[model samples]
Target: MKLYHSVDTRSLRCVWLLEELGVSYDLDVVPFPPRVKAPEFLAVNPLGTLPYLVDGDTKMSESVAILEYLLNRYDGGELRLTPDEADYGSWLNWMHFGEASLANIQATILRYTLFLPKPQRLPVVGEDLSVFLQERLKVLDAGLQGKTYLCGERFTAADISVGYALLLSSLFGYQKYFTPAITVYFDRLQSRAAYQAARAKS
Candidate 1:
């Protein structure tokens, strides 16, 4: 297996999963945000996105899908809640929520507030996204009120997915709005050995 990664990107989740699985793979670190300009990286993934994975003849991108494939193919389903599990539905909901809902707002906030040039940056738009993200985070906060992880007692890939968004939000200075419950949750996620290992590799 080979993972094309860049520091502090969504690739963090994939690398963390790989470490958790104890799978040996080559980590190909590249410059951030402009993988398209690198000819070698472009050959591996035409779209030139980070977290590109290759296993023999199969190739995958998108951190969430890659994680799903890895857990199913190699983890004996240990990293997921089976359909019969009590938190299965909640797990699926939160997994997609992390990316589809929360991540969209995070990217918008990054673009408007930090990544865009000064003249192009718009704090007003960024504030709107921040508000939207805070509202969405409330749903997660309520779900995590008395739980150890996103679903229930066990830690699964769902936590990794949502946790990354929370981490990114903190980096964007949105942690002040993080509910006390979620603040504790994010800290717990960061304290994991796998998270620390993956971050060190990045």
Candidate 2:
């Protein structure tokens, strides 16, 4: 197995899961915005996106989908909640919520605030998205009011999926608005050995 990743990108989700599963895989760290910085990578994945995975004949791009693929293909039973489990629906919902909801807004804020040139940067747009992101985060904060993890006590890939979004919130300077519950939850996630190991590799 091999993964193409870039520092602080969504690929961290996959790397963290690989560490948690204790799987052997090669990490190929490429420059960020590989589409422009690493033109050669376009041949490997036309999309030139980060978090690209190659496992034998299988290849994946979406970060959350990669997590599911890794869990299903690698017998990651310890960190997976099956369909028969009571919290299965919640688990799947939170996993996709991280990227589809939180990261989507965060990425737009990033684009308006930093990625775009100074003349193109729009503080008003970034501010509006930041407010929108906080609204989304409030839902997560409420859900985490009494749980150690997203699916109650079990530390599954759901945590890893959402955890990366929390990490991104902090990296993008929106953590100052993090609610108390979110702060505590993110602290717990950061303290995990697997998360720490993945950070080191990133």
Candidate 3:
């Protein structure tokens, strides 16, 4: 598999997953600013997003989907996904919430703060985002109250995905605004081996 990636982006999720899975493959790092719009890239994903993967001719986009695909298909090989099964109903639930709800909240903040030009950006956007993120983070904190990983006591690719999401909040300077338990959760995710590897590459 070949991964097309950019630093400090959603690509970190795949990088962490790759490290956790101990997969050997190729990586094409595209630096930021003008970003990657190579014709070859568009051929893999018409949307032209980073974290695009090409496993032989099987091209895939979207970080969450790719992580799940790699884990399920490759058995997460070594740092394998726990409670491994053909049926991943419970695992998918946590992943869906993190991808759909948590990512949406963070992406919104990114757009308003990072993507939008300062002159046109709304300064008050943080207040609105805080309401949703604070509530949502508490839910995640409650879910992890007695657990080490998202699905249970063991780490899985879901943690790689959601853990990267939490790291994103920290990178964006949003982690500190959350509750204490949430802050500690973000810290642990930051300190993981796979996460550190992804950060170095990113």
Candidate 4:
């Protein structure tokens, strides 16, 4: 298995999962802004996105999908919950919650606050996204009030998925709005050895 990745991107979540699973794989580091600068990488992933992966014939792009794929294929049922598990539905919800919902808002925040030129930047838009993200985070915060991890008593890939987005949000200055629960959750995630290993790579 080989992973095409960029630092400080969602690909780090996959790398973290790989580390936690103890899987051996090659890392193909690509410079940021590859879509315009790296034609060879575009050939591998027409979307030119981070977390493009090729595992003997199974090619994938989306970071969350790649994560699920890795867990399904490599893990011995530790990082995920099966359909029989009581927390299965909640697990799936939070897994997609990070990427599909929070990430979209984060992208908008990045576009207005960082990517756009000062003349074109919209602080109001960024503020609105911050509000949106904070509102969404409330759900997670409430859910985590009594639980050690997102799904249940044990840590799972659901934590990896949601944790990655939460980590990025904090780095992007979203922590000011974080509830105490979220702050504690983020700290616990940061304390993980696998997360540290992935951070070193990032």
Best model number under lDDT = 2
Best-to-worst ranking by lDDT: 2, 4, 1, 3
Please report, in order, the local distance difference test score of every candidate based on alpha carbons.
Answer: 0.84, 0.92, 0.74, 0.87
Candidate 3 per-residue C-alpha lDDT over 74-142 given as tens digits, one digit per residue, 9 for 90 to 100? 787533445556436666767767777687788887788778888877757866886888788888888
Q: What global local distance difference test value does model 4 have?
A: 0.87
Residue pairs clashing in model 3 are: none
Please provide, for model 4 over 1-84, each residue's C-alpha lDDT reduced to its tens digit, 9 standing for 90 to 100. Answer: 999888778898899999899899999888887876677898889888888889998998898898889888996377898889
lDDT of 2 by residue, 81-141 (tens): 8899888898899989999989878998999989999999999998888888988998999
Q: Please list the Cα RMSD from the true structure of every candidate, rounded to 1 decimal place.
A: 1.7, 1.1, 3.0, 1.5
Scored against the true structure, residue 82 in model 3 reaches a CA lDDT of 53
- For candidate 3, the 10 contiguous residues with the lowest summed lDDT are 78-87
Measured by C-alpha RMSD in angstroms, how accurate is candidate 2? 1.1
Task: Provide the TM-score for each candidate, comma-separated.
Answer: 0.92, 0.96, 0.85, 0.94
Rank by TM-score (best first): 2, 4, 1, 3
